[model samples]
Target: MFVRIVKLSFDPTKIDNFLSNFENQKNSIRNFKGCRLLELYRDKANTNVFFTYSYWDSEQDLENYRNSDLFKGIWANTKIYFNDKPLAWSVDKVVSLL
Candidate 1:
């Protein structure tokens, strides 16, 4: 499995707008082909900072989603609220306790 994590820092005053956008598009993202899991996390110390964790079947699957219009629209809307450039990582499991 391919694990993708994206860290986003939003404008503190526009966090609500970002959340609204996520609410509108998250289901489509989760249901996208080859998507295995999707989750969102908030930084306890900074509400304007958030992270998205997702699992995909492969790198190509993730790439396909990134190229789709769904991602285009979502990213277009989301990036408008950014306070900083987003950080993303794609990794594979080296080990799992479970």
Candidate 2:
């Protein structure tokens, strides 16, 4: 599986908006082709910072989703509330006890 992690920091006043958007779109995102799992996390000391963790069948599956209209639309709606540029990474598991 290919892991995708994205770190996002949003404008303080826009946090609620982002959360609402995520809640509404989470299902569609998780149901996207090749998406194995999806999760969201927030920094305990930094309420505005959030992270999205997901697993895809492969890098191509991730690329396909990134190229889709669904991604474009979602990104467009989501980016406007960002306090800073978002960061993302594609990683692999070296070891996982689970």
Candidate 3:
């Protein structure tokens, strides 16, 4: 499994718009081919900061999603609300205590 996390910092005034967009696209994104899981997390102390965590079957699968029209639309819309450049990372598990 491949894990991906994208941390985003949005304009406080646009937070609700971002969340609404995410809510509209969440299901389609989760059901994309090779997608295993998806989640949205917001910082407790700063609601404008958030992270999207997802699991994909492989890097190729993730790439496919990235290249899709759905991704293009959603990402473009999301970017409009950003307060700063987003941070994204893909990682392989080395150890799992759980």
Candidate 4:
């Protein structure tokens, strides 16, 4: 599986907007081609920070999503909420502790 992790820091005032957007669009995102799983995480110490963890059948699948109009519209709406540049990583599972 291909794993993608993205760290996002949002302006405190805009957190609600971001969360609302996520809640609204999450189902569509999870149902996208090649998506196996989709999850959202929040930082215990930083209320304005969040992370997205997703699993795909392959890296190409993730890329396909990233290049889609769905992503473009979402990203356009999302980037405006950021307080800092987002960080992302694409990785392979080394082992499953779970």
Candidate 5:
């Protein structure tokens, strides 16, 4: 599996709006082809910082979604609220206790 992690820091005032958008789209995103799992994590000490953790069948599957119109639309809308450029990483498991 391919693990995708995206860390976002939003403008303080835009945090709620950003999270609401995520909530609205979470189901659809998880249902996208080759998607295995999806999760959203918030930093307790920094409310504006959030992380999106997702599992995909492969890098190709993730790229396909990234190239889709759904991604274009969602990303275009989401970027407007960013406080800074977001950080993203694609990874594979080396070890997991769980």
Candidate 6:
């Protein structure tokens, strides 16, 4: 499986807007082709900072999602709320306990 993690920092004033957009689009993301799982997390010390954790069947699957209009529309709306450039990583599992 391919694991994808993305860290995003949003403008404090626009946090709610970002969350709203995420809430609206998350289901589509989770159900996208080859998607296995999806989750969201927030930093304990920084409410404006968030992370997305997802599992995909393969890099190509993730790429398909990236190239989809769903992603384009969501990212276009989400980027305007960014306080910093998003950081992302895609990796294969070395080991897992669960």
The model with the greater TM-score, 4 or 6, is 4
Put down candidate 3 lDDT per residue, 4-88, tens digits, no spaces.
Answer: 9999999999999999999999999999999999999999999899999999999999999999999999999999999999999
* Alpha carbon lDDT at 81, candidate 4: 99
Worst 10 residues of 3 by lDDT: 89-98
Candidates' C-alpha lDDT = 0.95, 0.95, 0.96, 0.97, 0.92, 0.96
Candidate 5: worst-modelled 10 consecutive residues by lDDT? 15-24
Q: Candidate 3 regions off by >4 Å?
A: 95-98
lDDT of 2 at 47: 93
Cα lDDT tens digits for candidate 2, 39-90: 9999999999999999999999999999999999899999999999999999
Model 5 stretches with alpha carbons more than 4 Å out: none
Give each model a TM-score: 0.95, 0.97, 0.94, 0.97, 0.95, 0.96
For candidate 5, the clash count comes to 0
Residue-level error in angstroms, candidate 2, position 97 = 2.1
Two-way lDDT contest, 5 vs 6, winner: 6
Across 1-98, the per-residue lDDT of candidate 1 in tens digits comes to 98999999999999999999999998999999999999999999998999999999999999999999999999999999999999999989788795
Candidate 3 positional error at 32, Å: 0.3
For residues 1-98, what per-residue lDDT tens digits would candidate 5 score against the true structure? 97999999899999888888888888989999999999999999998888999999999999999999988888987999999899999999778896
TM-score of model number 4: 0.97
What lDDT would candidate 1 get against the real structure? 0.95
**Deviation from native of the Cα of residue 37 in model 6, angstroms:** 0.5
Give one digit per residue, the lDDT tens place, for model 4 in 62-82. 999999999999999999999
The list of candidate 4 runs beyond 4 A from truth reads: none
Every model: Cα RMSD to truth = 1.0, 0.7, 1.2, 0.7, 0.9, 0.8
